[model samples]
Target chain A: MAALDRSLLVVIVDVNPAMWTAEAAGEHAPFVPIIRHLCMFINAFRALDGGNRLAIVACHAGKPTMLIRADEELDRSLHTVLDTALVLVLLATPDDPAQYNSVMNCIFAAQRAAIMIDCFAIRTSSTFMQQAAHMTGGVYVEPTAQQELGLAQLLITLALPDRACRALLRQPKAHDVDFRAACFLTNQLLDRAYVCSVCLSIFHHGDIIECPACRSRFPPPPRLARKRAKRAVAPAHGGPVIGGAHAAAAGAGSSAPRPAL
Target chain B: MADGRDARDARVSPLITFLVGQRRGRLGRLYANPWTCEAVVRALPPVARHYALRLVALGDTGDGATFAPATLEGWSLAHDAHQAALQWLLDLSIIERAEQPGALRLNAAFREQCGSLLCGLRPPAPKPPNKHTPSADELDAHAAAQWDALLYCVIHPSEWSDSTGYDMPAALLEPAGLIAARRVRARADGDDDDGDGGDDVDDDDGAETIEVWAMSKRGATFVLQDLSAQAWHILQVYIGDDERKLAFLLELAHMDFGHGYELRDEHRPLIAELHHLGIVHVRDAAKSKSFYPTRLAAAIVSSGDISPGGSARGRAIVESNLRVYVYTSSRAWTAILALFLRLRTLLPNAVVASITRERIQRAMREHGLSAEAIIAFLTRNAHEQVRRRPAEERDKALTVFEQIRLWERELERFTAKEAYYLSDFDTLALFDAELAHALASGTHLWHRREPGNARLCKLVLHEREDVIAEARARIKEFKRSAGLA
Candidate 1:
């Protein structure tokens, strides 16, 4: 037999608590069909190449568990031959901002390892998933309510294409990312957040006597809070030109008592 | 080596066409079955499989079969192997041309079946009966004993009488071309020369005759093939042109390795035959209600990863220095290596060996082993350690194969050919003209030139009398026209 140019595919199935039990969401998330779709998609993927190796991983409450990995002999030896490795994430829950840094770190590590991360979300595309897909140059597919009925078809059609075939095919383009950083204090998505002078701890509001994170002492907030609050509010509703002007003036005025980190 | 491989391909390619390309009407339903689909995929080339799989994933959509060929990039329609790959998919009916000119669509049945199979809709194999069933290891041992006994009987029948374990029917061996029988003039002369021929006689013709038995040419090459290939050949021999039986054999690959399926009235005869062939484990062909598919059965449609019977395990580490370390207790592994390698040490469950030139040459001469076959076997069974090595270091391992190839070539000292030599040319122009004519017809072999002369003095052409005679007539006409007659 000729030595085939084999590739490795890692499929991560996300079964987070929010996926099945829909307390806030209206409908029961057709678990059987989704599983059916995933299985069909994997079947189609495996069919595409005889030599292509695959591993399945289930991520639920805590750490991810590898459900199955074929041919353990190729475990780490795969890294060198792992040039064609692709990591696919089937995400159901929306991104939790608390785990944003960890997710991004994971994405960065995947990037450094040169593995592509493709995401197929249930209904809405999560922000972290979108970024991961975008950074790795993989398709991020979010089926519409109508398309979700034929999720198996969509998953197979869009997500099964390898790196070379994906280049030639029409894929679901990544949408415009929010690019906003979440505040560490409230875990809320924010366009602009107040940063502590000492610890650089982010928050939605600026009314604080001391840095909560670093315990750095500061003068009472009445004078500093009033000015920082106005500067932050004026730019969000204003035009880009006005926002730039406001930001520049605030930076110029902030030379009074800025703490060195 | 190259000739041997091409010949084997000539034998196997048609088997693919035969297995997969059945009655078209029956094929749609066959495609709807996952087992059939699995078997079909195994028959296709790697590239065509990729293309078929991609198109299958594209789905029928009901909007119209997708315009897929247009979406595919970097394809050249004019004389490309990629074109052949596309044609193969079309031939297999995995995909077909749509209403649009270049559009291709997936077979609807194939697509739906792939979905449900992956979706876990297929029922699991039934559990074992209350009676004891053979374990996987026991099955392997049984298969090995059966296969080795059959092979030993065919290769050397002097040691074993009819009472031993494997009484592989001679009827089965003849059709496979493993053993051949011929009636020679039964001379009442020297008995010493009958060392290789078995004296199995048929007195049905009322003539005093002894049937001489020997391994055929196909058998020489057949002996060197791995277990999967050998099993497939055996099955092909069993399932000749019977389409129903061919389809039935494909089911074994899809069946669970150790599970048993109850045999129906129609399937009983086939299962009994498969039992003798070591494909299925049927303890009592008449009394047993069900038959178990052995690992050899898996090889009927197995891809490379499938560890078929006793053969497909990758326990050997073939290094750059031509050293082989086999970590297998199976005699099959050591015996195959012994065909080409010079053994140095034999520890328990392991063997140390080196590939020496003389052994390879001897195997080439005696066992009809080819360099390509040896190299292919080594790489196919190579440990993951070889796969993990750096690319530069990998080249070193490759060089070892190249050395083996060179050694094979080194044995070819000269080639003999039949040709007609034409000489004594009067002019450079006439010599060149004759050379051009011969070259155009592809009968010209070579021309000789003296050290001091620029003009060709002699030309050698192929030994085709008709072509040579035609050339003679043309030369006569030319000579008369040029006033040299």
Candidate 2:
């Protein structure tokens, strides 16, 4: 018999009030139903193994905080329990730009820990969340409105297995990953961008004399050269298209990049 | 006590054996206590614990209808895990077949307690005063000291005799069969013939034999196991057939580490037992004082992790050349290492030892230590040097580990069993009939010759008692009918 594989699962919930209220008015239910489904999924995960642990983190507009830290709630004092996390489940919609840094910090931490960050985009597709999931070798699924009833099923079928079980079972793959980067200054997704050499921060426009992030001053682009570069890169519709063809089709009307502030 | 078979079967975990021996009524009463229920749930194997949790959750949701056999079969895809979980639950009397066919139900009291636990409705015990509460480190120190003293009493009784001013619970040790009072003295001048090196025998002559204490084989095995496992084994030995002590120990297993619980009147004797076993430490021992559960007590029912105190001090640096460096000055630990390793040198803070085939075999054949237990001990106590090694380099020690296991397996290769070798029948037909009966009953071990023209057969162990008896009765009838009675 194989040895028992202990695992820790971190469930990150996007408790955005406005999105849930809008969904509550629509066909999708409010936070209560979603929470119920999440609770069922958590119980299922816990049932996988006696040593398996579950932690719940809620992301509000201000800062992401751990709603239920497994170590504290279960009173686990073992060092093994504290050292590693196996999976991170993010139930999210479109998030506020202010929480970008904090959410990214969580993603990078999970990445460094070798944790799979499974993203379940409930209402709207989050490009940042997709990137996080893709980079971490986790499954990213944005279920349509008709498939909302199968949220719990999706969690069990797609994200329940640990790395060991994933070795034998066929895993869900993210077909089209949005590689678009958000401008550090405006926190806006940019289709065509210029990156700062020192800090590697992306910018929406390259006309500035000094880099906004690192203040690395460079000679301004020649006026005639800037116009030629703009005409060469601009699409026929004069609109910035983010992501690949699949993403553009899924987010047809919402594909326009936010104007630079 | 009966034979080697009984002794070998006794190697199963004492906790499981004790739980299996419990009566349904006693088990129900034990489970009625929330603490005992929680401990039992936590002590179950991983698969069994998951099954219990799922059942408890179902009970909370009032889903009794789904517990039918047909529906429950879909619970897990792994058939082995499902079967093992069900068997364990049945053995512990946690669940039983219902009056209706194809249905199962949890014991009423167990179901209620488990439901309460899952729903987080268990009422917390009254809080003790914050003052005088011990820190985690202090508790660890007390636990380690108390445990070491107990082990010293068993492993090195000579050293135990030199220590004074501390109660050693010698009487408890005697009853647990861990230590026995014996006589020891230096060899006399006139009796100097060398025969065998009997370590426990008194070699003195024409003089009074000084009484001393020595450990038994069971005591040797006890010292080598981890602290939590040792506590359980000791409790099983001390409790014997008493169900109340088992219940109390289970309740103690549920107590939170580093927290003080009120010392009720009924808890006095149990607390004293735990104190003697080094599972808990009482501050004042007064009637109304509170008792703190040490790391040992709290971790007794934990499935995977050992106590924090032991984990910190269990570091043993093992080299590929079979040399070992244990970083501790504790006498109890040294005594344990001496059982399976050739001690070379003892420094102020470390002890150097080497693993040898003879020592390992002696531990397995004489002391009843299993290969799995030894492997688990070494793996748990692996030092930082070994732990930090790259994955490819870690396989270097695998050869040594395999050798130790092979030595142990060699000792267990031949097992003697009690069986009846049947022969000498007047007719071949009678022998054939008897052999057929034995085979049909599933008690046939082997046959010396074919039943066609010979009359030799052997029957070994049977799963049920009635199978052998029924076969014997059938053989007697056949003999009478053949006029051979």
Candidate 3:
């Protein structure tokens, strides 16, 4: 029998109560209408084929609230799971940097597995989401022109089709993506940053004292000993002596070590 | 996925399949009713259902009635993925090519009815289910008794013993091709198995021939089919060529199961036949005010997909030790289990049985059930709990199925078949021509180019009269084509 392209749509609905309930202050679209559109879109996806499977993750307050399957184990499963998986993120809130690594991990996992990751940024356009959609060969749509009015139609036309038909689809023009990592401690996007060698944590500050995520000290302990040696030499020679740690730290931060050859 | 490969699915109701074969006018008329639309929607393939659900809602009278086949609604799906679904819709007349080349139009009758349905207009609501209504179990027993007694007439023909129950449903059995008349010689001993269905008749003079009704080959296979298929097969026979009756049956499939509905005048005769077949239950078949669709009726239609072997309902759990727990109370189901299962303990609702090698061999040798059928029966009926179990535990359960197959292989040597052997060929050229004809026609079971002499060859053809007739013509045609006149 011919193998069917059985789509596995993972719809991560932004049910963040913070975003949905922000009516007076923030201009977020009504929750009910978005949910209704989502439901119709889900129905449309199911209509596409009989064997298609879907997982809806309701992210309440930017945390996976309920329904089915843990998101934590998804990256591991991506290797074994269906190739036709499409993770559609419907983001309403601003970027939650705490979940950046996880989101990025999932995006890369999806990319590696050849799974498409479509992002519909409702309220705020996320740089990570844009990059994710761009990398994974999926459409990134931030339909900010008319919030509620053509949401359903936009979703069906743009994101409903899989990667094969998507080539022909008139997708929402993707803006420039910031292929930059955010600091775990500062939560600020950075072009260049220091990464802890042990924990792989990003640090943008001058000299890394300690890793914020894994709490592993980033060579500052060795720097203190090097400072003591410099101080001991300074007293003997009464002259300025540069610490070896400074030269070592600069060369050590980058991913790979230089070969002598 | 054509999940129906295991079971002859009621997915496209045998009724719908029949209607599809009829004239477009009759099929369109059938689609006129909303209930028929509802039934068709249930039976539609998932992809096709998806399009119908959207398009039918858009099928209003005025503007935007037609949809472009190449646009978002149709074209949004992957190109190769749903072409089959689109074609299926066209075949069923749910959608058709409009005047323009690329445009598609929903069937007018189907759309109108489906539109009314989408607008929430429905047939009279089933009266709120009564608290005092007979329990589902009780109804099962009632249906079982009525249905089994009818089938019992087939299995243990009442003529042989004093176990007289329902009259020989020869009207049903004969017409349905479940049983056929065969004239047998009434010997003094009368110990033949075929002698039981005593439709014995004295032919004019001294007792020369006795016409006995025996089970047909179709009837033998019918027994192996699960309940849903058996029910549909009967309906297929019952609702032969009657478009109006078939329409009513589709409408009936839409009705609530277990709830009694008022039987209209038009449906009275149909209800009588259905009641006799234990599909629908009426207080009195003579004058019925209301008829309740039995579980059998519900099983045939309401169940999403009905396979020939069985529904993969996962009603039974197979343990590592080969013990089986079947969660059903139906006597008919138990009767099937008795074929291969070593029934250990029979509870009120569950049957605890063992998959013994002896029982498996017996079921194979006596009942002619294949190892694959037995394994499929177990797999399809695998308990939900078994699916939920850990991989190793599930694998353990799987090994039990493997054992049954292994045992069957161990015991198997040669199987018998009924076929006609043709021998006597003038030359090798003639023999090769006939062999090619039979093989191409699928009637050639076995053939030998030369049994003894190079001139003569042995060939076996299927014994079925229709197949033999067609094979003979094909063989002659091949001879003529080869210029071996």
Candidate 4:
């Protein structure tokens, strides 16, 4: 039976320096105060449903990291409960934002050492905190630097119930998610490019005589001699022949089938 | 745990081994906590609890389950722990497992029995209850109220002392040290002089409380008063051997109880009480999970139609019924059944008895049985049959209207009997004592009392014990007030 009473709520507190810096400049609650308040709110939620879950996400520079993931396992597979926080000490460095994965790895390793517990992903997902909470049927809360939304209020009201009983009420829904794909070619997000009709492969400019995806060849046309033969057919025929030449030309034209991958 | 296991192993034998192996079959899942154990414990009736507790205690280690089939009772420990515990522990987050294998461990902080997590364990502030105990009079009044509640379940408040069986609940007697020894007395055929006319009567001895097993004036009053019409009828059929209540329950399983009756956890107790009453029998089905009703349970519903037969005919029914059903046929059931006439039946097996309309009408007329009382008798018997389905079933099949009709015709022959009247009391003290005495005698009724015009409290009695007892108490109080005693 679907347990109608239990629920899990995961609050991913994004502590990215670049993101929070912008927010800190705004006329809103400072990031530190928000984090402190969010922790207390999480405690309140745990009191409501003592078994409800909470996770924190910190994004520094552009790398998203986890500050606190309740460690009940010891594996990378969302199942491991390790008291590990992925904190990036090098957030102050002006490194390329693309080095985010490396920063995340360091943060995860540091958090693991602090707890001295193994990490297992048996029940949790791959993302810094969102995926872990998602696997366990918990709510995922990730506040970005761009919005000065009332995240604390949202946490209190929305993340109260455990996952089992949360189905009846309307909750925050993610509709237009960022589905931009990272290119295998340059490892950068791609917008538009030549796609292989047969294999659905995408590519930049290549030889016109050959298809890059399937390596199929296309024969070039003999231009001058073909035009001279057309002139010969027009003189040999009368008005019917002029029209016959057009018919013959029309008959000669044919389209090839598109190639399969 | 090991010491307990060794003791259990010492008692093991070949037949016992076979029984334990058959009972255990297999144990599945592990329950390591008291929270889990409590769920399984509550589902069991007291008898099952007695055995199950012994079984579990003999083998259970206070940790996650370790199935040691050979060590304890020679049975496999393959029972599902969560099922036994009813999943309450899962709700508490004290134990986490999955319906299937390979589920990840959700992280939870482990708290010890330390000060950080203790919520409600403050030492309660001392109170002066021990220092200022209630006075003797107050204690007596409090004890009376508590005793009344327990006793009230057996006999209705108005008919408390009038029950013929006079069997007080064990709870009441336990405190009073009035429990009768469990010995069957030697019976004298014709030599027993049962009347007040007997030579050299030993009546002044402790005989005041030692009423005869089957018949005594106070005991008969109590037994009769204890008879709700339906229960009385159920006893009648069992005595008649018409049908065992168990068989009736099996047939009733096919019938419907109106209004989607959802049998809840609480209803189990009420059903168990009926079983305890010896009105029905439930047996474990062969190699199955649930219990099946036996043949004796079948006639429970029909028994409800019986009116309270008077003492003469009722006694015969009780004796005959007692002879047929050896187990669970209580003295109270037999006494209640003795009210009808010519109850004997020459049956080869089970009960081959028949009750006539004339006998029923005669019983009503002689015993002053009310129409409501007669109907109540049949309905209570019918309920055992009806309970086969869970109480929460949509349609309850037993018809109350049918039983009521049976009594209406039977009651026409009865003549009104006058009860004693006591009124114009000068003091509250007089009125209260008289009321209590009247209630104790099991004959008090609000219907006989009128207000303002009469200035009198009236009580109707087929017997005047209620009034007589009350009058005696009032006279004593009156003398005490006048300083004559």
The C-alpha TM-scores of every prediction are 0.66, 0.60, 0.56, 0.25
Best by DockQ: 1
lDDT of 4 by residue, A18-71 (tens): 545565688444446445435544544333322234455554545667666754
**Which window of ten consecutive residues has the lowest lDDT sum in model 4 chain A?**
A115-124
TM-score of chain B of 2: 0.69
Choose the strongest candidate by lDDT: 1
TM-score of chain A of 3: 0.71
Better of 2 and 4 by DockQ: 2
lDDT of 1 by residue, B114-195 (tens): 6555555543465665466787787887776666655554554323344424434465677777767655446577131422
Question: Per-residue lDDT tens digits of candidate 2, residues B112-175?
Answer: 7765554344334735658788877888888887778788777765455423244454656667
TM-score of chain B of each: 0.63, 0.69, 0.66, 0.22
For model 4, the stretches where C-alpha displacement exceeds 4 angstroms are: A1-13, A17-29, A53-149, A159-166, A172-179, A187-261, B1-485
Model 1 misplacement above 4 A: A1-125, A135-138, A161-169, A194-201, A205-261, B1-32, B39-88, B98-105, B108-112, B115-120, B129-131, B147-210, B305-368, B378-407, B418-485
For model 4, the docking class works out as incorrect
- Give the per-residue lDDT of model 4 (tens digit) for B1-485: 22222222122112122112221112111122222223222222222222233233222213323322222222212223213222222222322353445331211221221111112222112222333333334433332333233233332222234223433343233223222222122334422332222232334454333222122222223334423332433333222322223223323322221111222243333334333333222221122122222212322222112222211112111121212211112323432443432334433322322344554455455444544554444334433334354654413322323433475565654666665655655555556655676677677654234444434644433356656775767667796987766
Docking quality band of candidate 2, CAPRI definitions: incorrect
lDDT of 3 by residue, A100-134 (tens): 77877877777778889888888678877877887
Q: Give one digit per residue, the lDDT tens place, for model 3 in B1-485.
A: 55222222235545456556767676788888877777676566544555676565344324556778775344433443356557667778888788988888889888878766644554555555565455556566567666665554454342422232334446566677776676666767764353222434445566667666665555545565656666766776677777667777766655666687777887876776676666677776557566777656645544343422222256888888989899877665676677578889999989999999988877676546777777767776777787788888778776887898888887776677899988767567667877887888788898888745745678898887987777577667866887877
Q: How accurate is candidate 2 locally (lDDT)?
A: 0.64
Which ranges in model 3 have alpha carbons more than 4 Å from their true place? A1-119, A122-124, A128-180, A220-261, B1-19, B32-64, B67-83, B101-103, B112-130, B134-136, B139-175, B181-205, B208-214, B237-485
Residue A226 of candidate 1: its Cα lDDT? 54
